[model samples]
Structure formats: structure tokens, C-alpha cells
Target chain A: AQSVAQPEDQVNVAEGNPLTVKCTYSVSGNPYLFWYVQYPNRGLQFLLKYITGDNLVKGSYGFEAEFNKSQTSFHLKKPSALVSDSALYFCAVISDTGRRALTFGSGTRLQVQP
Target chain B: EADIYQTPRYLVIGTGKKITLECSQTMGHDKMYWYQQDPGMELHLIHYSYGVNSTEKGDLSSESTVSRIRTEHFPLTLESARPSHTSQYLCASSEPMGNEQFFGPGTRLTVL
Candidate 1:
């Protein structure tokens, strides 16, 4: 079974500082990775996905993620964090097989302090 | 933008009462799913549908049941509400062979 892991329960960063949220995955074959952000009392919004090619994938809200195949990691990053960027972030992975369903990680709470 | 909608954003019901949480998407995606989440826990998939008249249980065991009678609507029902069922229920839709999913505003339920 495919699964995703988010190591941190919460990450605090000063506004305008760079931020990183770590994610790793275990799958049978090539992985389809994705990042989603959820605001308070709102649904999750799609940030970006990595299906094939391009180890460094750029996403919405000035976020990007690097997919490291050897380490089985796809960590989300932002050059300069803003207070509005604070939200719950989830990393997901799907196997290359036909299932096409996503296995989500335990979400990481990102807090950007002004 | 994909238009996915969930009704009753918040619900507080008594034990043993039957309730249904409605989910609809106008994106015309052929795949829809239901997920249960606690305040700060991992999302657990409870049910999913490949298309109309198709529904399957997901990775997590859930007491609620779901039906997909139409291509765009997938509603989940619980025969008897329980305190353990109190959590946030999210609805999502995606293309038939697509990996990216669009989520709807979750329905928060509290069984008292």
C-alpha cells in the first residue's frame, strides 16, 4: 500500500523568511505527489503535483516542492513566507498503478508570524 | 474553477438520529470520494465512487454509507449517529484518470 509521511506536526516561521515542510513517501512504483493547503473552516486547495519529469515543481501561492526520488521525499518550500500563507499543508502520493487514489500524509500546521 | 459543494457546513445531532451529508460537484468529474478527518489528524478515506451507480468503501472503516445515483452528486448517510462519528467530512472530485482532486468545504458533525 502507498503511504505518505509528514514529519512535523507544526512549523513556525517569521514573516518574509523562507519555510520548508518535509514530506516522504513509500510506494510500489513511480509516485504521483501533490501538495494541498487548507485554510480555517475551508476546503483544501490544490497547490501543485508531480506526475513525471521536473524534480522541482512550482505551485500556487509562491510555493514549490522538490521531489527527491532516492530519498523518497517531496518537501514543500516557499522563498518568502507571508502571514496569509499560514495554513494546514498536506502531502499526498499515489502509486503508478491504476488505483489512482491518493494517500495523504498527516497534515502539517504552518504558522507564519508577523 | 471546479465547483464542488457540500451542504450543512456544521451539524449537531442527537444519538440514534439518521442524517445524510450531501456533496455535489459541477466539474463533471467521473470520480468522487468521501473523507473523514479529526481536528488535527490524518485524513482517512471512507468511501469513493468511480462513476454513477458505483460506490466503494475506502481505506478507513466507516459506519456511514454512500450512494452515487447521479454523476455529480454523492451523498453519505448514517443510519444511527454516534459520538464517535463526530468529525469533519470532506467531499472531493477528480477526473477519471487524474491524480489531482478538488475538495469541497467540509461538513463538521457533532453527535451529542
Candidate 2:
């Protein structure tokens, strides 16, 4: 079974500082990785995804992720953090051979302090 | 924002009451999914459909039932609302074999 792991329960960062939300995955074959953000009382919004090619994938709202195949990690990163960037972030994965539905990791709460 | 939409963004109902949470999309997506989420938690898929007249249960076991009678509409029904069913229900749609899905504003259901 394909699964994603977000080790951090919460990450605190100062506004304007670079932020990183760590994610790792386990799958039978090559993996497709994704990141999503959820604000209070709202549905999840897609941030980015890595399907194939390009180890560095950029996403909406000045966010990006680096897919490291050797480390089995796809960490979300931002050049600088904004207070509004504070939200719950989730990492999801789906293997090329397994079930089509994505398996999500426990979300990480990002708190960007001013 | 995605063209998908969910009705009754907030719903409160008594236990044993029958409720149908409506979901519709204007994007004409062939694949639609329903997910249940608790506050500050990862979403769990409850139901999904590839197209009209095709519905399948997801990884999680859910008592709620869903129907896909039209390409644009996929509604989930709870035969008996229970306290355990109180959670946010999200609807999503994507094109055939599309990797990313577009989500609708979730419906928060509180069963008392």
C-alpha cells in the first residue's frame, strides 16, 4: 500500500523566514506526490504535485516542493513565509501500480508568527 | 476556484434523521469523490464514482451511501444521522486519470 508520512505535527516559523514542511513516502513502485493546504472551515486547496520529471516542482502562491527519490522525500518549501501561510498542510501519495485513490498523511499545522 | 460546489455548507440534524448532502460540478469531470474529515485531520475517502451510474466504496468504511445519476451531480445520503457522522464532508472532481482533483467547499455536518 502506498502511504505518506508527515513527521511534524506542527511547525512554527517567523514571517519572512523560509519554511519547510517535511514529507516522506513508501510505495511499491514510483510515486506521485502532492501537497494541499486547508484553511479554517474550508476544503483543501491544491498546492502542487510531482508526477514525472523535474525534481523541483513549483506550485501556487509562491510555494514549491523538491522531490528527492533517494531520500524518499518530497518536502514543501517557500522562499519566504507569510502570516497567511499558516494553515494545515497535507502530503499525499499514489503509486503508479496501486489503487488510484491517494493516501494522505496526517496534516502538519504551520504557524507563521509575525 | 474550482467549478465544483457543495450545498448546505453547514448542516445540523438530529440523530436518525435522513439527510442527503448535495454535490455538483460544472467542469464535467468523469471522476467524483466524497471524503470525510475531522477538524484538523487528514481526509478519508468514503465514496467515489467514475461516471454516471457507477459508485464504489472507498478505503474507509462509511455508512453513508452515494449516487451518481448525472455527470454533474453526485449526492451522498446518510440513512441515519448519528453523532459519529458529525464531520466535514468534502466533494471533489477530476478528469479521467487526472492526477489532481478540484475540491468544493466542504459541508460541515453536526449530528446531535
Candidate 3:
């Protein structure tokens, strides 16, 4: 079964500082990784995905994630954090050879202090 | 933005009440999914539909039931609402073989 793990329950960073939210996955086959953001009382918004492309995938809202094959990780990063960027981030994975539904990790809350 | 939509964005009901959460998508996607999530928590897939008339249970065992009577509609029904069923329910859709699944705003259901 494909699964995703987000070790950190929460991450705190000051506004304008670089931020990284860690994510790791386990899949029997090649993994299709994705990142999503959720605001309070709102549904998840898609960020970016890694299929079979370049390791570095740029996403909406000036965010990017690196797909590390050897490490089995896909960590979300931003050059500078904004107060508005604070929200819950989720990491999801689906195996190409397994069921199409995504397996999501426990979300990591991002706190950006102004 | 994705065209997926869910109705009753916030619902509060009493125990044993019957309720149905509605989900619809305008993208003509072939797959639709229903997920249960506590606030700021991980998502649990409760049910999904391949297309019209094709519904399947997901990884999580849910007391709710779902139906896909049309290509664009996938509604979930709970026979008996309980406190344990209180959570935000999310609806999503994706085209066949598509990598990304579009999400709805979600319905926050609270059973008292």
C-alpha cells in the first residue's frame, strides 16, 4: 500500500524567511507525489505534482517541491514565507501501479509570524 | 480553478437524523471521490465512483453510503447521523488517467 508521512506536526517560520515542509513516501512502484494547501474552513487547493518529470517542480503561489528519488521524499519549499502563506499543508502519494486514489499524510500546520 | 462543488457548506444536525451531502462537478471528469477529514487533519477516503452507476468503498470504512446516478453528481447519504460522524466532508473529481484531483470547498457536518 502506498503511504505518505509528514513527520512534523507543525512548522514555524517568520515572515520573509525561507520555509520547508518535509514529506516522505513509500510506494511499491513509481510514485506520483502531490502537494496541497488548505485554509481554515476551506477545502484543499492543489499546489503541484511530480509524475515523471524534473526533480524540481514549481507550483502555485511561488512554491516548489523537490522529488528526491533516492531519499523517497518530496519536500515543499518556498524562497520566502509570507503571513498569508500560513496554512495547513498536505502531502499525498499514489502509486502508478496501484489504485488511483491518493494516500494523504497527516497535515503539517505552517505558522508564519509577521 | 476546478469546478467541483459541494452543498451545505456547514450543517448541524441532531443524532439519528438522516442527511445527504451533495457533490457535483462541471469538468466532466470520469472519477469522483468523497473524503472525511477532521479539521486540520489528514483525509480519509470514504467512497469513490468511477463514473455513472459505478461506486466503490474506499480505504476507510464509513457508515455513510454514496451513489452516482449521473456523471456529474455523487451524493453521500448517512442513515443515522452521530457525533462520531461529525467532520468536514470533501468532494473531488479527476479525469481518467489524470494526475490531479480537483476539490470542492467541503461540507462541515456537525452531529449533536
Candidate that scores best on lDDT: 3
Find the 10 residues in a row with the least total lDDT in model 3 chain A: A93-102
lDDT of 2 by residue, A1-114 (tens): 888999999999999999999999999988989999999999989999999999999999999999999999999999999999999999998888856577889999999999
lDDT of 3 by residue, B20-41 (tens): 9999999998899999999888
Candidate 1 backbone clash number: 0
Interface RMSD of each: 1.1, 1.4, 1.1
Best by TM-score: 3
lDDT of 3 by residue, A1-114 (tens): 899999999999999999999999999989999999999999999999999869999999999999999999999999999999999999999888857599999999999999
lDDT of each: 0.93, 0.93, 0.94
Per-residue lDDT tens digits for candidate 1, residues B2-108, read 69999999999999999999999998899999999998778999999999999999999999999999999999999999999999999999985546999999999
Each prediction's TM-score against the native?
Answer: 0.98, 0.97, 0.98
TM-score of 1: 0.98
**Tens digit per residue, CA lDDT, model 2, B1-112:** 8899999999999999999999999998999999999999988999999899999999899999999989999999999999999999999997755378889999999999
Where does model 2 sit among the CAPRI classes?
Answer: medium
| CAPRI quality of model 3 | medium
